[model samples]
Target: MSWNIFEKLKTVFMKVTQILVKLFKKTNKSTSLTPVSNVIATPTAHYEGVQTATIIAIPTNIAKAVVNCCLKNRIDLAEAIFRGFGYGNTKIVVTEKEIIAETSSGIVLLDPSKYRLSEL
Candidate 1:
């Protein structure tokens, strides 16, 4: 029993570490030597903020997708999480009318609130 608990903690820690690494990786570009792009396709502020929410602005869309995947696999998404390094602080949660994917990308939409805390 203790061993199982320890393993779970270890997995969670590793996942958190990997997420942090991805979120704050060191860039090797030196401004003096590197070239800047003229087409500013990406907005830096937004990228540092809500990236996941930007990917799928309409929550219903991602919810539908997650629901479809769950139905096809016959898996209880609330109980089964993809233990992946790319995920964030929590786990993916799915319900009949809502979806929470904070663990997957640091994106959260709680009731009337919608935003991401990936920068921390």
Candidate 2:
């Protein structure tokens, strides 16, 4: 038993910290086995208008406070009072019947005919 240089630098620093904690636990168990490997599974709702683009999860400041409370209660009564409160979630809720143009540069437009709620 004759080691010493501080036990050969503490056995090469415990075999380089056990090979860096087994390479960070095998890269966190291969990233928890592909938790949605590329993650793009949430599409399928495109009818464009009378509402149906819901993909909610909630929090883009509570979905822009439910799209500014359905754009202040009258864009078709806030598009029938915005409702897409989560069921799968990736954040989407487009109810477009918008058509409010008044653009010289003051910019106030929508689409489908027009919507100008006095250029909010």
What TM-scores do the predictions have?
A: 0.27, 0.20
lDDT of each: 0.34, 0.32
Which RMSD values do the candidates have, in order? 14.1, 25.2
**lDDT (Cα, 0-100) at 67 in candidate 2:** 35
Model 1, range 35-115, lDDT digits (tens) per residue?
Answer: 222323432212223232222112232334344544445544343333221233323344433344432123443331221
How well is each residue in 1-120 modelled by candidate 2, as lDDT tens digits? 223432333343334434544665777533311112122232432334333443322222223333344455433323332432232332234345432211112212223222333432
Q: Candidate 1, residue 63: CA error in Å?
A: 1.8
Which structure among the candidates has the greatest TM-score?
1
Global Cα lDDT for candidate 2:
0.32
Q: How good is model 1 by TM-score?
A: 0.27
What candidate 1 gets wrong by more than 4 Å, as runs, is 1-58, 82-92, 95-97, 101-120
Candidate 1 Cα RMSD after full superposition onto the native fold (Å): 14.1
